[model samples]
Target: MPQPPIVHTHRKPLVYALVWASLPAATLAQEAQPTVLDAIQVSAERGEPASESTSSYTAASSRTALKLALSHRETPQSVSVITRKQMDDFAQTDVNDVLEGTTGVTVESVETDRTYYTSRGFNIDNFQYDGVGLPAVYDNVQGDLDTAFYDRVEVLRGANGLMTGIGNPSATVNFIRKRPTVANRASVAVTGGSYDNRRIVGDVSGAVTASGKVRGRVVAGYQNRDSYLDRYNNEKQMFYGVVEADLTATTVLTLGHASQTSDTDSPLWGALPLFYSDGSPTHYQRSTSTSADWSYWDNVQHNSFAELSQQLGGGWQAKGSVLRLEKDSDSELFYQYGTPDRQTGEGLFAYPSQYELNTEQWVADAYATGPFSLVGRIHELVLGATWSRSETVDESRYGQGIGTALPPLEEWTGSYPKPTFDNGISGSDWTDKQTSTYAAVRWTLADPLTAITGVRLTWLDSEGVSYGLSKATRYNAVETPYAGLIYDLSHNHSVYASYTEIFKPQTEVDRDRNRLDPIDGVNYEVGLKSDYRAGRLKSTVAVFHTEQDNLAEAAGTFDNSVDSYYRGVDGLTSEGIELELAGEVSDRVQLFAGYTYVDIDTANGHTAKPSIPAHLAQLRATWRVPGTTGLALGSQVRWQSAIRQNQGTVSGGPNDGQPIVTRQSSYAVLDVMARYDFARNWRAQLNVNNVTDEKYIESLKKFGTSAQGFYGAPTNANVTVSWTY
Candidate 1:
């Protein structure tokens, strides 16, 4: 990413117009004095780009947690930034893949194409494009965004209601896009891997005007690959283009567009059954898949955005941005689940389903920041406003009759005949709208102590019409406040304490068939942040506690003639501690390591959330050979404690008399990478994942007796060759 300098000024349009009007005369004068023009060009080229940073793996500053740029030591919340170098070394291709290696974050796949991310015992439902927040909906189409067009991904842990108007208390993820650069640059790469995988990518960027004030960039990529599973294959295509212009010395303008499409054939709808009809656990091969040959899932996304930034006098700046996003998806899937007889596989069943959805969203935000004098002390202040709206239309259909019987397990193949179905019924049409005004101030209370306080006034409205239901919900004039205090223990160490709030509207119904009120919560955290080796290395140790009320849970029982309902729980609490270290440890060594422990419980203990491990740790290190130039090797290790799901009791089956307390034993995975600059302008690299080929379950259903668990990927490797010009 490359950005123009931040400008703070008034009368931006007038200033730019005057500058453009004088360009001809300035050019003529410069032509007459070549020496003066050369000096000016050199000075201009020396100016640093706003988006490019000198840090190798650590970020110097971020604006995701708060709308103001702050360093890691200054921010009160835990933040993780994955830079371009890390993504390339880890071979991360998509948003989900990147988060999988991120600290304190967990990724789970419900199906082949549907993925979910969680942090600190809650689901992460807040996402941003640049600095603008977007609606977070848990649809299959929203989680497969590609990372080719992004420069980096930033994750802020814990509650962030000050910036994101309505969201869960987990965390917020921000994707920063790449921008045009002032200098000419181009690169191309080709990759080949196991399962017949192949991919190619090209990028080009340069100035379009002789004055070097106007620049443009374009990136394109294509990939096609076969999976380890039978009959499963995927193809992806992506494109991105951006144009930037220096309207004036103090003003910059940017416009960009991006698009991605994924086409997957023979996609799996669900995992295979875990138990046999005789109450015995069954074992399946790592490559076993429950998909039919006719299954397919296809999705397409398009995004367009514009931004304007102006430098105001006296350390002040103003910036504004608008973004529009549209996504469409169509999927046809076949699922296999049900107990199978030990010998005949008599009870095996198949389910076929299809769905289509179209979603569109628009977001706009503007902010101004500058220094102000209060009580003879200069303080930093920021004020901003944001508006967002989203709408989704979906249609779906499922097989009407009873499940179709499948062949014996030993004789089953993936070439089942495609089933014919009727036209799908209209599913749901919904719209969400939100608006907010926010302000924050960095108060200089003393020489070594500073306080940050912020507040947001929000208005939200949601309306929807479903197959057999219609409803409207509104939260008007809600207020969320934030407060934090930081004390410098030393030049390289800081201790901070912060408090934040959370507000999320739930659609769950009560025993009377009425929707429950919104859930409210508060988060408290105390942490120590440190920077070493001139900010090249960063580390944090934090402890956090969160409590929520009015949590919706299942009611004891429901009347046969009426729909089931939920009841609000009085108390729900989650406590956790996290430790992380990331960045270059030495000139030849780069390292990243993290550890987390979390405990969550409900007042009644009967409705506790599951699938969250009690402990998790991750470590990765890369070393460049001291004697061999352009040669580097890296290794990574990830481990998690056991995860248990309390399924309560089985209903009516071979294991009816037993309790379904399913547990997945602890697991660990290893990965290795090597890169060598074999030539002047060319390089080759290899990445091997799951080095030991560990086999384990990645996700398990509450009722483990059912067939609803996902398996981890087996060992695989890829080789890539890249060229730069």
Candidate 2:
């Protein structure tokens, strides 16, 4: 995406006055002058614009960690921002697709509808919207989440304890929504591609009142597509609308609503068998599937929010916001297990079931930030508080045949008789609540030195019943401390170091049938950051080390009730190094690239997390043809080291009690794209992914004789046509 005209974050009379002041000079000029220069100069006085239409891969500043607007050179963390333009160029319409291209992040597509993410050798459980945290009730993405309603995705790598109540030490992902604009503008896009894929999206934003005091925006889209896997398809619909009103000269009120639905057919419940009866790895075609013709999983989600902000005197501001989120899912699925014969393909079984789950959450937060002077030096301080409550309910129904043996695999199709769901039903109900207060300050210690320190106090309570077990937990006055220092090495270079603590509440119990204490850890990092090309380009080199205690590990023992238990493992450590560069290299060339290397020490000869690769690399760039007007070319390359999983023993087959293993060697994927602008307001783009058609497994952790595993997509192409006014 190319850079668009810049605009102010908050629309006010001062913006209108500045625009009018520049108009006269532009009108009197002999040659037509680009008005974007004037807009950029004026918008610079205010905060940087969101990445909505910036068309650049880098952001000028972000406040995802401590609610302070600081540039990458000033912040003491590694961050990656996926801009809207990058999404359009690569056709990354889903969150999984986007994160797969990010730096130091891994997307684990364990199942068709269930996904997991990890970073720096830890699981990611923290997610935010426009700087506000929202806990994941299920700790997994249950369905495909579209990106049509978001302007950009900000990824902060490493532990973030101040903002997110539960610090997981993995990463934090923040989604920034598209807001209403003071200028009237509209755009529509139509796309079609391989597998009979089809989609259409529309966006309209402008002033609702003649005086521009009130503004509104609307975005809607629909997509239907077939997958490379056999007997699988999905349809999606999404809508978002927001309105902003300037109630007074220095006060603003905003309201927004967003909804999305996913309807999928033949979604997989469990993956194909990865090993044969001979204890050897099994290979299948890329188009192979384990779903029945009648199996389906559907999901819907709705979100509503309201915010009010007041600009106080002397550079001080106060803001309050509330958000409500609801989600529901329904599925009827079939699971297959057992290793079959390598020659005759026999000895497999099936289990059928139905499930329904629902989740509701409410979150609200308020904060005040401004500058203060002490000892003839100026500094900044922020104070905030947050409250959140989430409830989840689920029910499961088993079919008549608990475990029915299957026919020969070679002759078997998804043509089994639908079992009668006459068995009894079981359900679970759980609720969790959290309250937190935090304070942070930035002190200008010297001419070239700066320091930031903060702390958070959190209270947690959870209660409910899971299956036939009781679930109750409580914790009070959990304190997490944060501190950082930065020293300016030069006008455009800086060196920094930071230390932070992490805490996560676990649901598993110890062998004694007692709920284990929460997991706690600490992180230390130091890095060098530099800016070039007048802040249009940025680079960072960081080294991080994390030490964790009280991590849950399987005890390999069952309690009196036959339920599995776990024990706390301490002294686990992970250390890594990261390198990144993003932004325009020159007038006609732009690039974003990164490389990450991590090493883990289990500290007790425990089986390490083999699914996380030791090395990762991502490269994306775009170049404009010098002689050809309105023509550009781009490409993306991603590579990762080998990953493997050790499945204990083949069960219930000719190779019973035999060791099995699944592995995917190191590989790289390449994608190419071309875009052409034909008319004043129209353009067309073509994107081809996996150009080499590399065949690889999407995830290895979910691999076993019966559980989960899938293949990545093959060579595919899509064409998009867009018009803007």
Which prediction has the highest TM-score against the true structure?
2
Off by over 4 Å in 2: 1-48, 408-410, 510-514, 554-567, 605-607, 650-658, 702-707
Give the distance in Å from residue 246's predicted Cα in candidate 2 to where it truly belongs.
0.8
Local error of candidate 1 at 31, Å? 54
Pairs of colliding residues, candidate 2: none
lDDT of 1 at 454: 75
TM-scores of the models, in the given order? 0.89, 0.91
Give the count of colliding residue pairs in each prediction: 7, 0
- Give the per-residue lDDT of model 2 (tens digit) for 347-417: 67887788899998889999888765544456777888999998989998877775688876455567878
- Tens-digit lDDT string for candidate 1 (182-209): 7898999899999999999898988999
lDDT (C-alpha) at residue 337 in model 1: 62
